[model samples]
Target: MNCEKIKESVSIRTVLESFNLLPAKENRKTAFYFALDREEKIPSLSVDFVKNKAFDFGTGKSYDVISIVQQINKCSVSDALKYLHKFDLSVLEKESVAEIDYSKNYEIIQVGNVRHPALVQYLKSRKVFEQRHLVKELVYRFNGRKFFGIGFLNDSGGYEIRNKYTKICLGQKDVTWIKNGCNTNNEVIIFEGFFDYLTYRMIEKEENSIPDHLILNSTAMLFKVKDKLKVYHKISLFFDNDHNGRDTKKMIQDDHDNVEDCSLLYIDFKDLNEWFCNFIEKL
Candidate 1:
Protein backbone atom coordinates (compact mmCIF):
# COMPACT_ATOMS: atom_id res chain seq x y z
CA MET A 1 0.00 0.00 0.00
CA ASN A 2 1.04 3.56 -0.63
CA CYS A 3 2.08 5.72 2.33
CA GLU A 4 -1.13 7.75 2.34
CA LYS A 5 -3.31 4.68 1.94
CA ILE A 6 -1.41 2.90 4.74
CA LYS A 7 -1.76 5.90 7.04
CA GLU A 8 -5.48 6.01 6.45
CA SER A 9 -5.94 2.24 6.75
CA VAL A 10 -3.82 1.32 9.79
CA SER A 11 -4.35 2.63 13.31
CA ILE A 12 -1.49 4.03 15.36
CA ARG A 13 -2.30 1.57 18.15
CA THR A 14 -1.58 -1.35 15.84
CA VAL A 15 1.77 0.11 14.90
CA LEU A 16 2.67 0.81 18.54
CA GLU A 17 1.62 -2.67 19.71
CA SER A 18 3.69 -4.18 16.93
CA PHE A 19 6.67 -2.70 18.81
CA ASN A 20 5.37 -4.21 22.08
CA LEU A 21 4.32 -0.78 23.36
CA LEU A 22 1.08 -0.47 25.32
CA PRO A 23 -0.77 2.58 26.54
CA ALA A 24 0.21 3.75 30.03
CA LYS A 25 -3.13 5.50 30.52
CA GLU A 26 -6.04 5.56 28.13
CA ASN A 27 -9.66 6.49 27.62
CA ARG A 28 -11.99 5.70 24.78
CA LYS A 29 -10.85 8.48 22.48
CA THR A 30 -7.23 9.10 23.50
CA ALA A 31 -4.38 7.09 25.01
CA PHE A 32 -1.04 8.09 26.48
CA TYR A 33 1.95 5.96 25.53
CA PHE A 34 5.57 6.12 26.66
CA ALA A 35 7.68 8.19 24.34
CA LEU A 36 9.43 6.23 21.59
CA ASP A 37 12.59 8.31 21.68
CA ARG A 38 13.51 8.45 25.35
CA GLU A 39 13.15 6.94 28.79
CA GLU A 40 10.56 8.83 30.85
CA LYS A 41 8.51 8.41 33.99
CA ILE A 42 5.24 9.68 32.56
CA PRO A 43 3.77 8.76 29.19
CA SER A 44 3.91 11.74 26.83
CA LEU A 45 2.85 10.15 23.56
CA SER A 46 -0.79 11.05 23.13
CA VAL A 47 -2.67 8.98 20.59
CA ASP A 48 -5.96 10.04 19.03
CA PHE A 49 -7.74 6.98 17.71
CA VAL A 50 -10.34 8.87 15.73
CA LYS A 51 -7.69 10.80 13.84
CA ASN A 52 -5.30 7.81 13.60
CA LYS A 53 -2.41 10.05 14.70
CA ALA A 54 -0.14 10.66 17.68
CA PHE A 55 1.64 13.61 19.23
CA ASP A 56 4.69 13.43 21.44
CA PHE A 57 4.13 16.06 24.11
CA GLY A 58 7.69 15.61 25.29
CA THR A 59 9.32 16.24 21.93
CA GLY A 60 6.62 18.43 20.38
CA LYS A 61 6.48 16.16 17.33
CA SER A 62 3.53 14.70 15.49
CA TYR A 63 3.14 11.31 13.80
CA ASP A 64 0.78 9.30 11.68
CA VAL A 65 1.04 5.55 11.10
CA ILE A 66 3.85 5.86 8.54
CA SER A 67 5.93 8.37 10.52
CA ILE A 68 5.44 6.52 13.77
CA VAL A 69 6.83 3.36 12.22
CA GLN A 70 9.73 5.35 10.87
CA GLN A 71 10.38 6.93 14.28
CA ILE A 72 10.22 3.66 16.21
CA ASN A 73 11.99 1.44 13.68
CA LYS A 74 14.32 4.18 12.32
CA CYS A 75 13.56 3.00 8.81
CA SER A 76 13.09 4.64 5.46
CA VAL A 77 9.70 5.51 4.01
CA SER A 78 9.88 2.46 1.70
CA ASP A 79 10.63 0.09 4.59
CA ALA A 80 7.93 1.64 6.80
CA LEU A 81 5.35 1.18 4.07
CA LYS A 82 6.44 -2.45 3.66
CA TYR A 83 6.10 -2.95 7.44
CA LEU A 84 2.61 -1.43 7.41
CA HIS A 85 1.50 -3.85 4.71
CA LYS A 86 1.70 -6.81 7.14
CA PHE A 87 -1.22 -5.53 9.26
CA ASP A 88 -4.78 -6.62 8.52
CA LEU A 89 -6.38 -3.19 8.31
CA SER A 90 -9.96 -4.39 8.79
CA VAL A 91 -9.28 -5.96 12.23
CA LEU A 92 -7.16 -3.05 13.40
CA GLU A 93 -9.83 -0.58 12.42
CA LYS A 94 -12.41 -2.46 14.47
CA GLU A 95 -10.18 -2.52 17.54
CA SER A 96 -9.19 1.12 17.22
CA VAL A 97 -12.76 2.36 17.01
CA ALA A 98 -14.20 0.33 19.88
CA GLU A 99 -14.98 2.46 22.97
CA ILE A 100 -14.10 1.21 26.42
CA ASP A 101 -16.51 1.83 29.30
CA TYR A 102 -14.01 2.58 32.07
CA SER A 103 -16.73 3.31 34.64
CA LYS A 104 -17.90 -0.32 34.50
CA ASN A 105 -14.50 -2.00 34.21
CA TYR A 106 -14.08 -2.64 37.93
CA GLU A 107 -15.67 -1.82 41.28
CA ILE A 108 -13.97 -1.73 44.66
CA ILE A 109 -15.75 -4.02 47.12
CA GLN A 110 -13.57 -3.72 50.23
CA VAL A 111 -10.22 -2.48 51.45
CA GLY A 112 -8.88 -4.09 54.61
CA ASN A 113 -5.87 -5.70 56.20
CA VAL A 114 -4.10 -8.74 54.74
CA ARG A 115 -6.09 -11.63 56.19
CA HIS A 116 -6.99 -13.84 53.26
CA PRO A 117 -5.18 -17.18 53.40
CA ALA A 118 -4.44 -17.13 49.69
CA LEU A 119 -3.09 -13.60 49.85
CA VAL A 120 -1.06 -14.40 52.96
CA GLN A 121 0.46 -17.39 51.21
CA TYR A 122 1.16 -15.32 48.13
CA LEU A 123 3.11 -12.83 50.23
CA LYS A 124 4.96 -15.63 52.02
CA SER A 125 5.92 -17.18 48.73
CA ARG A 126 7.57 -13.91 47.79
CA LYS A 127 9.32 -13.79 51.21
CA VAL A 128 7.55 -10.54 52.04
CA PHE A 129 4.87 -11.63 54.52
CA GLU A 130 6.44 -9.61 57.33
CA GLN A 131 6.11 -6.52 55.20
CA ARG A 132 2.40 -7.18 54.66
CA HIS A 133 1.47 -4.10 56.62
CA LEU A 134 2.70 -2.00 53.70
CA VAL A 135 -0.12 -3.37 51.57
CA LYS A 136 -3.82 -4.09 52.01
CA GLU A 137 -6.31 -6.78 51.05
CA LEU A 138 -8.33 -5.46 48.14
CA VAL A 139 -11.58 -7.18 47.26
CA TYR A 140 -12.95 -5.93 43.97
CA ARG A 141 -15.51 -6.88 41.33
CA PHE A 142 -14.91 -7.05 37.63
CA ASN A 143 -17.13 -8.29 34.84
CA GLY A 144 -19.80 -9.52 37.26
CA ARG A 145 -17.24 -11.61 39.15
CA LYS A 146 -15.61 -11.05 42.53
CA PHE A 147 -11.84 -11.15 42.98
CA PHE A 148 -9.21 -10.24 45.51
CA GLY A 149 -5.55 -9.28 45.52
CA ILE A 150 -2.79 -7.71 47.61
CA GLY A 151 -3.26 -4.01 47.12
CA PHE A 152 -0.57 -1.32 47.45
CA LEU A 153 -2.05 2.14 47.54
CA ASN A 154 -0.50 4.89 45.41
CA ASP A 155 -0.45 8.68 45.74
CA SER A 156 -3.51 9.07 43.53
CA GLY A 157 -5.52 6.59 45.70
CA GLY A 158 -5.21 3.80 43.12
CA TYR A 159 -4.39 0.27 44.17
CA GLU A 160 -1.62 -1.77 42.59
CA ILE A 161 -3.55 -5.02 42.92
CA ARG A 162 -1.57 -8.22 42.63
CA ASN A 163 -2.38 -11.91 43.02
CA LYS A 164 -0.66 -15.11 41.95
CA TYR A 165 -2.97 -15.28 38.95
CA THR A 166 -3.57 -11.60 38.22
CA LYS A 167 -1.98 -8.16 38.28
CA ILE A 168 -4.02 -5.03 37.71
CA CYS A 169 -4.78 -1.52 38.93
CA LEU A 170 -8.01 -0.22 40.41
CA GLY A 171 -8.47 3.55 40.06
CA GLN A 172 -6.01 6.22 38.83
CA LYS A 173 -2.43 5.00 38.41
CA ASP A 174 0.28 6.91 40.28
CA VAL A 175 3.35 6.52 42.45
CA THR A 176 3.43 5.75 46.18
CA TRP A 177 5.79 7.96 48.17
CA ILE A 178 6.40 7.11 51.81
CA LYS A 179 8.21 9.91 53.51
CA ASN A 180 10.29 9.44 56.63
CA GLY A 181 8.58 10.96 59.65
CA CYS A 182 8.89 14.76 59.57
CA ASN A 183 10.90 14.47 56.32
CA THR A 184 13.97 14.07 58.45
CA ASN A 185 16.00 11.97 56.02
CA ASN A 186 18.27 13.46 53.38
CA GLU A 187 18.49 10.13 51.54
CA VAL A 188 15.82 8.27 49.61
CA ILE A 189 15.44 4.82 48.10
CA ILE A 190 13.46 4.34 44.93
CA PHE A 191 11.80 1.12 43.79
CA GLU A 192 10.13 0.18 40.55
CA GLY A 193 7.25 -1.59 42.33
CA PHE A 194 5.86 -2.15 45.80
CA PHE A 195 7.14 -5.73 45.88
CA ASP A 196 10.70 -4.56 45.38
CA TYR A 197 10.31 -1.95 48.08
CA LEU A 198 8.98 -4.61 50.46
CA THR A 199 11.89 -6.85 49.58
CA TYR A 200 14.34 -4.11 50.50
CA ARG A 201 12.62 -3.67 53.85
CA MET A 202 12.73 -7.42 54.42
CA ILE A 203 16.46 -7.67 53.76
CA GLU A 204 17.50 -4.55 55.62
CA LYS A 205 18.06 -5.63 59.23
CA GLU A 206 18.17 -2.13 60.68
CA GLU A 207 14.78 -0.47 60.78
CA ASN A 208 16.11 2.97 61.70
CA SER A 209 18.67 2.97 58.89
CA ILE A 210 16.12 2.67 56.12
CA PRO A 211 15.67 5.93 54.24
CA ASP A 212 12.54 7.44 52.81
CA HIS A 213 10.90 5.13 50.27
CA LEU A 214 9.28 5.82 46.94
CA ILE A 215 7.46 2.97 45.28
CA LEU A 216 7.08 4.01 41.66
CA ASN A 217 4.33 1.44 41.09
CA SER A 218 5.65 1.70 37.56
CA THR A 219 8.82 3.08 36.02
CA ALA A 220 6.48 5.34 34.09
CA MET A 221 5.78 7.10 37.38
CA LEU A 222 9.37 8.20 37.85
CA PHE A 223 8.50 11.48 36.22
CA LYS A 224 5.93 12.19 38.91
CA VAL A 225 8.58 12.16 41.61
CA LYS A 226 11.49 13.79 39.78
CA ASP A 227 11.22 17.08 41.61
CA LYS A 228 10.63 15.31 44.90
CA LEU A 229 13.79 13.26 44.40
CA LYS A 230 15.97 16.34 43.92
CA VAL A 231 15.74 17.20 47.57
CA TYR A 232 17.56 14.05 48.67
CA HIS A 233 21.32 14.02 49.01
CA LYS A 234 21.43 10.36 47.99
CA ILE A 235 19.05 8.48 45.73
CA SER A 236 19.36 4.68 45.63
CA LEU A 237 17.46 2.82 42.93
CA PHE A 238 16.19 -0.76 43.35
CA PHE A 239 14.82 -1.27 39.88
CA ASP A 240 14.44 -4.62 38.11
CA ASN A 241 17.40 -6.05 36.22
CA ASP A 242 15.82 -5.61 32.82
CA HIS A 243 15.89 -3.18 29.92
CA ASN A 244 13.16 -0.90 31.23
CA GLY A 245 14.61 -0.90 34.74
CA ARG A 246 18.12 -0.15 33.55
CA ASP A 247 16.82 2.60 31.30
CA THR A 248 14.93 4.23 34.14
CA LYS A 249 17.90 3.95 36.46
CA LYS A 250 20.06 5.68 33.88
CA MET A 251 17.47 8.38 33.47
CA ILE A 252 17.48 9.03 37.20
CA GLN A 253 21.26 9.10 37.22
CA ASP A 254 21.32 11.54 34.36
CA ASP A 255 18.96 13.87 36.15
CA HIS A 256 20.60 13.74 39.56
CA ASP A 257 24.14 13.87 40.90
CA ASN A 258 23.94 11.47 43.85
CA VAL A 259 22.16 8.56 42.15
CA GLU A 260 23.11 4.94 42.79
CA ASP A 261 22.01 1.84 40.88
CA CYS A 262 21.38 -0.88 43.47
CA SER A 263 20.17 -3.50 40.98
CA LEU A 264 23.76 -4.77 40.77
CA LEU A 265 23.22 -6.41 44.14
CA TYR A 266 20.72 -8.77 42.51
CA ILE A 267 22.10 -8.64 39.00
CA ASP A 268 21.48 -12.33 38.40
CA PHE A 269 17.82 -12.16 39.36
CA LYS A 270 14.90 -10.46 37.64
CA ASP A 271 14.12 -8.23 40.61
CA LEU A 272 14.80 -7.71 44.30
CA ASN A 273 11.79 -9.86 45.28
CA GLU A 274 12.93 -12.70 43.03
CA TRP A 275 16.38 -12.58 44.58
CA PHE A 276 14.90 -12.60 48.08
CA CYS A 277 12.71 -15.60 47.20
CA ASN A 278 15.73 -17.45 45.86
CA PHE A 279 17.67 -16.61 48.99
CA ILE A 280 14.86 -17.98 51.17
CA GLU A 281 14.68 -21.13 49.06
CA LYS A 282 18.39 -21.70 49.56
CA LEU A 283 17.98 -21.33 53.34
Candidate 2:
Protein backbone atom coordinates (compact mmCIF):
# COMPACT_ATOMS: atom_id res chain seq x y z
CA MET A 1 0.00 0.00 0.00
CA ASN A 2 1.30 3.44 -1.00
CA CYS A 3 1.25 5.12 2.41
CA GLU A 4 1.90 8.67 1.26
CA LYS A 5 -1.01 9.02 -1.16
CA ILE A 6 -3.40 7.61 1.41
CA LYS A 7 -2.12 10.15 3.95
CA GLU A 8 -2.69 13.23 1.77
CA SER A 9 -6.10 12.13 0.56
CA VAL A 10 -7.10 10.67 3.90
CA SER A 11 -7.22 12.40 7.28
CA ILE A 12 -7.98 11.38 10.84
CA ARG A 13 -11.53 12.45 10.15
CA THR A 14 -11.65 10.29 7.05
CA VAL A 15 -10.44 7.22 8.95
CA LEU A 16 -12.90 7.89 11.76
CA GLU A 17 -15.71 8.35 9.27
CA SER A 18 -14.71 5.23 7.38
CA PHE A 19 -14.59 3.14 10.54
CA ASN A 20 -17.55 4.98 12.16
CA LEU A 21 -15.63 5.68 15.34
CA LEU A 22 -17.31 7.47 18.22
CA PRO A 23 -17.35 11.26 18.87
CA ALA A 24 -17.83 12.03 15.23
CA LYS A 25 -16.74 15.30 13.64
CA GLU A 26 -19.27 16.70 11.16
CA ASN A 27 -17.35 19.53 9.51
CA ARG A 28 -13.78 20.42 8.47
CA LYS A 29 -13.60 23.31 10.95
CA THR A 30 -14.68 21.05 13.79
CA ALA A 31 -12.13 18.49 12.62
CA PHE A 32 -9.25 20.98 12.54
CA TYR A 33 -10.24 22.93 15.68
CA PHE A 34 -11.04 19.90 17.79
CA ALA A 35 -8.04 18.13 16.27
CA LEU A 36 -10.20 15.08 15.75
CA ASP A 37 -8.68 14.86 12.28
CA ARG A 38 -5.27 14.15 13.80
CA GLU A 39 -4.12 10.52 14.09
CA GLU A 40 -1.86 10.52 17.19
CA LYS A 41 -2.95 13.07 19.78
CA ILE A 42 0.33 14.42 21.12
CA PRO A 43 0.15 16.88 24.01
CA SER A 44 1.74 19.70 21.98
CA LEU A 45 -0.78 19.58 19.13
CA SER A 46 -3.64 18.78 21.49
CA VAL A 47 -2.54 21.60 23.82
CA ASP A 48 -2.14 24.38 21.28
CA PHE A 49 -5.14 24.41 18.99
CA VAL A 50 -4.76 27.90 17.56
CA LYS A 51 -1.34 27.80 15.85
CA ASN A 52 -1.76 24.43 14.07
CA LYS A 53 1.91 24.52 12.99
CA ALA A 54 4.92 22.37 13.89
CA PHE A 55 2.91 19.45 15.24
CA ASP A 56 4.60 17.37 17.90
CA PHE A 57 3.09 14.26 19.49
CA GLY A 58 4.70 14.92 23.00
CA THR A 59 7.20 12.02 22.71
CA GLY A 60 9.86 14.30 21.20
CA LYS A 61 8.40 13.50 17.79
CA SER A 62 7.74 16.29 15.30
CA TYR A 63 6.30 15.95 11.81
CA ASP A 64 5.42 18.37 9.04
CA VAL A 65 2.36 18.02 6.79
CA ILE A 66 3.75 15.09 4.84
CA SER A 67 4.81 13.18 7.93
CA ILE A 68 1.53 13.89 9.67
CA VAL A 69 -0.28 12.63 6.61
CA GLN A 70 1.75 9.45 6.61
CA GLN A 71 1.17 8.86 10.33
CA ILE A 72 -2.58 9.41 10.08
CA ASN A 73 -3.12 7.33 6.94
CA LYS A 74 -0.61 4.60 7.83
CA CYS A 75 1.46 4.82 4.66
CA SER A 76 4.93 5.91 3.63
CA VAL A 77 5.30 9.59 2.66
CA SER A 78 6.24 8.63 -0.91
CA ASP A 79 3.29 6.24 -1.39
CA ALA A 80 0.63 8.35 0.37
CA LEU A 81 -0.66 10.04 -2.79
CA LYS A 82 -0.93 6.88 -4.86
CA TYR A 83 -2.48 4.90 -2.02
CA LEU A 84 -5.22 7.48 -1.66
CA HIS A 85 -5.93 7.51 -5.37
CA LYS A 86 -6.34 3.73 -5.55
CA PHE A 87 -8.16 3.30 -2.26
CA ASP A 88 -11.39 1.34 -2.69
CA LEU A 89 -13.84 2.91 -0.30
CA SER A 90 -16.55 0.46 -1.27
CA VAL A 91 -14.40 -2.59 -0.58
CA LEU A 92 -13.19 -1.36 2.80
CA GLU A 93 -16.54 0.15 3.76
CA LYS A 94 -18.46 -3.01 3.23
CA GLU A 95 -18.77 -5.03 6.41
CA SER A 96 -15.94 -7.56 6.37
CA VAL A 97 -17.26 -10.76 4.79
CA ALA A 98 -14.71 -12.56 6.96
CA GLU A 99 -16.22 -11.65 10.33
CA ILE A 100 -15.55 -14.40 12.90
CA ASP A 101 -18.06 -14.16 15.74
CA TYR A 102 -16.68 -16.73 18.17
CA SER A 103 -19.66 -16.76 20.49
CA LYS A 104 -20.50 -20.31 21.55
CA ASN A 105 -24.15 -19.44 21.08
CA TYR A 106 -23.52 -18.91 17.39
CA GLU A 107 -23.81 -21.80 14.93
CA ILE A 108 -20.13 -22.62 14.45
CA ILE A 109 -19.03 -25.69 12.56
CA GLN A 110 -16.88 -27.79 14.84
CA VAL A 111 -14.64 -30.56 13.57
CA GLY A 112 -13.37 -32.50 16.60
CA ASN A 113 -11.89 -29.73 18.80
CA VAL A 114 -11.31 -27.07 16.12
CA ARG A 115 -13.87 -24.39 15.28
CA HIS A 116 -13.83 -23.64 11.55
CA PRO A 117 -16.64 -21.12 11.01
CA ALA A 118 -14.68 -17.86 11.22
CA LEU A 119 -11.53 -19.34 9.74
CA VAL A 120 -13.47 -20.77 6.84
CA GLN A 121 -15.23 -17.48 6.14
CA TYR A 122 -11.96 -15.54 6.30
CA LEU A 123 -10.18 -17.97 3.95
CA LYS A 124 -13.09 -17.93 1.54
CA SER A 125 -13.06 -14.15 1.49
CA ARG A 126 -9.30 -14.09 0.91
CA LYS A 127 -9.68 -16.91 -1.66
CA VAL A 128 -6.93 -19.18 -0.34
CA PHE A 129 -8.46 -22.51 0.64
CA GLU A 130 -11.08 -23.52 -1.88
CA GLN A 131 -12.68 -26.16 0.32
CA ARG A 132 -11.12 -28.39 2.98
CA HIS A 133 -7.68 -29.03 1.48
CA LEU A 134 -5.79 -26.60 3.70
CA VAL A 135 -8.04 -27.37 6.63
CA LYS A 136 -7.43 -31.10 6.19
CA GLU A 137 -3.71 -30.54 5.94
CA LEU A 138 -3.78 -28.36 9.04
CA VAL A 139 -5.81 -30.95 10.94
CA TYR A 140 -3.30 -33.66 10.01
CA ARG A 141 -0.38 -31.43 11.01
CA PHE A 142 -1.67 -30.64 14.50
CA ASN A 143 -2.69 -34.31 15.04
CA GLY A 144 -6.43 -33.50 15.20
CA ARG A 145 -6.27 -31.30 18.27
CA LYS A 146 -9.00 -28.70 18.81
CA PHE A 147 -8.19 -25.02 18.21
CA PHE A 148 -10.20 -21.82 18.05
CA GLY A 149 -9.74 -20.18 14.67
CA ILE A 150 -9.36 -16.50 15.38
CA GLY A 151 -8.64 -14.91 11.98
CA PHE A 152 -6.97 -15.80 8.70
CA LEU A 153 -5.22 -13.97 5.82
CA ASN A 154 -5.27 -16.01 2.60
CA ASP A 155 -2.97 -13.50 0.98
CA SER A 156 0.61 -14.68 0.45
CA GLY A 157 2.36 -12.02 2.54
CA GLY A 158 2.94 -14.40 5.50
CA TYR A 159 1.32 -17.18 7.57
CA GLU A 160 0.41 -19.65 4.87
CA ILE A 161 0.66 -22.81 6.93
CA ARG A 162 -2.08 -23.93 9.34
CA ASN A 163 -3.62 -27.06 10.79
CA LYS A 164 -6.95 -28.21 12.22
CA TYR A 165 -5.79 -27.81 15.82
CA THR A 166 -4.05 -24.50 15.05
CA LYS A 167 -5.74 -21.12 14.90
CA ILE A 168 -4.38 -19.84 11.60
CA CYS A 169 -4.64 -16.10 11.22
CA LEU A 170 -2.71 -13.16 9.88
CA GLY A 171 -0.69 -12.80 13.06
CA GLN A 172 1.98 -10.18 13.77
CA LYS A 173 5.71 -10.87 13.23
CA ASP A 174 6.29 -12.50 16.65
CA VAL A 175 4.11 -14.13 19.31
CA THR A 176 5.03 -14.29 23.02
CA TRP A 177 3.97 -17.46 24.83
CA ILE A 178 3.71 -16.98 28.60
CA LYS A 179 4.21 -20.50 29.95
CA ASN A 180 2.76 -21.20 33.39
CA GLY A 181 1.80 -24.51 34.92
CA CYS A 182 -0.01 -25.33 38.13
CA ASN A 183 2.79 -27.67 39.22
CA THR A 184 5.46 -24.95 39.08
CA ASN A 185 5.38 -22.03 41.48
CA ASN A 186 5.10 -18.49 40.05
CA GLU A 187 7.56 -18.50 37.13
CA VAL A 188 7.20 -17.27 33.55
CA ILE A 189 9.06 -18.05 30.32
CA ILE A 190 8.24 -15.94 27.27
CA PHE A 191 8.76 -17.39 23.82
CA GLU A 192 8.11 -16.15 20.30
CA GLY A 193 5.61 -18.09 18.12
CA PHE A 194 3.63 -21.27 18.80
CA PHE A 195 6.45 -23.45 17.49
CA ASP A 196 8.46 -22.26 20.43
CA TYR A 197 5.55 -23.57 22.47
CA LEU A 198 6.16 -26.96 20.83
CA THR A 199 9.91 -26.66 21.44
CA TYR A 200 9.41 -25.84 25.10
CA ARG A 201 6.91 -28.66 25.32
CA MET A 202 9.45 -31.05 23.76
CA ILE A 203 12.48 -29.98 25.86
CA GLU A 204 10.74 -29.94 29.27
CA LYS A 205 8.30 -32.74 28.52
CA GLU A 206 9.55 -34.91 31.36
CA GLU A 207 9.47 -32.20 34.03
CA ASN A 208 6.33 -30.76 32.41
CA SER A 209 7.52 -27.33 33.50
CA ILE A 210 4.82 -24.74 32.88
CA PRO A 211 5.59 -21.04 32.63
CA ASP A 212 3.25 -18.22 31.65
CA HIS A 213 3.52 -17.74 27.87
CA LEU A 214 3.16 -14.26 26.38
CA ILE A 215 3.15 -14.25 22.59
CA LEU A 216 3.08 -10.70 21.21
CA ASN A 217 1.83 -12.23 17.91
CA SER A 218 3.60 -9.29 16.31
CA THR A 219 5.68 -6.31 17.40
CA ALA A 220 2.58 -4.15 17.09
CA MET A 221 0.41 -6.45 19.21
CA LEU A 222 3.13 -6.48 21.91
CA PHE A 223 2.56 -2.80 22.60
CA LYS A 224 -1.13 -3.46 23.00
CA VAL A 225 -0.73 -6.64 25.08
CA LYS A 226 2.06 -5.29 27.36
CA ASP A 227 -0.34 -4.41 30.17
CA LYS A 228 -1.17 -8.09 30.65
CA LEU A 229 2.48 -8.79 31.50
CA LYS A 230 2.51 -6.44 34.52
CA VAL A 231 0.89 -8.84 36.97
CA TYR A 232 3.35 -11.68 36.41
CA HIS A 233 5.84 -12.33 39.26
CA LYS A 234 8.83 -13.23 37.13
CA ILE A 235 9.04 -12.93 33.34
CA SER A 236 11.76 -14.23 31.03
CA LEU A 237 11.09 -12.72 27.60
CA PHE A 238 12.67 -14.77 24.79
CA PHE A 239 12.58 -12.65 21.66
CA ASP A 240 14.61 -12.25 18.46
CA ASN A 241 16.41 -8.92 18.65
CA ASP A 242 16.04 -8.04 14.98
CA HIS A 243 14.70 -4.74 13.62
CA ASN A 244 11.03 -5.32 14.36
CA GLY A 245 11.84 -7.68 17.22
CA ARG A 246 14.08 -5.09 18.91
CA ASP A 247 11.33 -2.53 18.62
CA THR A 248 8.96 -5.07 20.16
CA LYS A 249 11.30 -5.51 23.15
CA LYS A 250 11.78 -1.76 23.54
CA MET A 251 8.06 -1.13 23.33
CA ILE A 252 7.44 -3.73 26.04
CA GLN A 253 9.95 -1.96 28.30
CA ASP A 254 8.82 1.57 27.54
CA ASP A 255 5.08 1.00 27.63
CA HIS A 256 4.86 -1.35 30.59
CA ASP A 257 5.09 -0.29 34.24
CA ASN A 258 7.15 -3.37 35.23
CA VAL A 259 10.48 -4.73 34.03
CA GLU A 260 11.51 -8.33 33.27
CA ASP A 261 14.65 -10.06 32.08
CA CYS A 262 14.27 -10.47 28.28
CA SER A 263 16.84 -12.66 26.49
CA LEU A 264 17.96 -12.26 22.87
CA LEU A 265 19.16 -15.81 22.09
CA TYR A 266 16.90 -15.74 19.03
CA ILE A 267 18.82 -12.64 17.87
CA ASP A 268 21.31 -14.90 16.07
CA PHE A 269 18.42 -15.88 13.80
CA LYS A 270 15.05 -14.43 12.82
CA ASP A 271 12.88 -16.35 15.31
CA LEU A 272 12.85 -19.26 17.75
CA ASN A 273 11.68 -21.75 15.12
CA GLU A 274 14.66 -20.95 12.94
CA TRP A 275 16.92 -21.50 15.92
CA PHE A 276 15.11 -24.75 16.71
CA CYS A 277 15.45 -25.96 13.12
CA ASN A 278 19.16 -25.14 13.20
CA PHE A 279 19.56 -27.04 16.47
CA ILE A 280 17.98 -30.06 14.83
CA GLU A 281 20.12 -29.55 11.72
CA LYS A 282 23.32 -29.91 13.80
CA LEU A 283 21.97 -33.02 15.56
248-278 in candidate 1: lDDT tens per residue?
9989899999888888889999999999898
Candidate 2 lDDT, 1-283, residue by residue in tens: 4444344433433333233332322222332222324455422342221222333334556444445446667777566454343233332333112353222122223324223444453343333333333233222212222223433222222232343223334322334343445726455565554444444444455446566655444445565556667666666666665776667667666755444634455556766656656675568
Best by TM-score: 1
Q: Candidate 2 vs. truth: CA RMSD?
A: 19.7
Q: What residue runs in model 2 are displaced by over 4 Å at the alpha carbon?
A: 1-185, 205-209, 255-263
The per-residue C-alpha lDDT of model 1 at residue 237 equals 88
* Poorest stretch of ten by lDDT in candidate 1: 94-103
Clashes of each: 1, 33
Off by over 4 Å in 1: 1-104, 182-185, 207-210
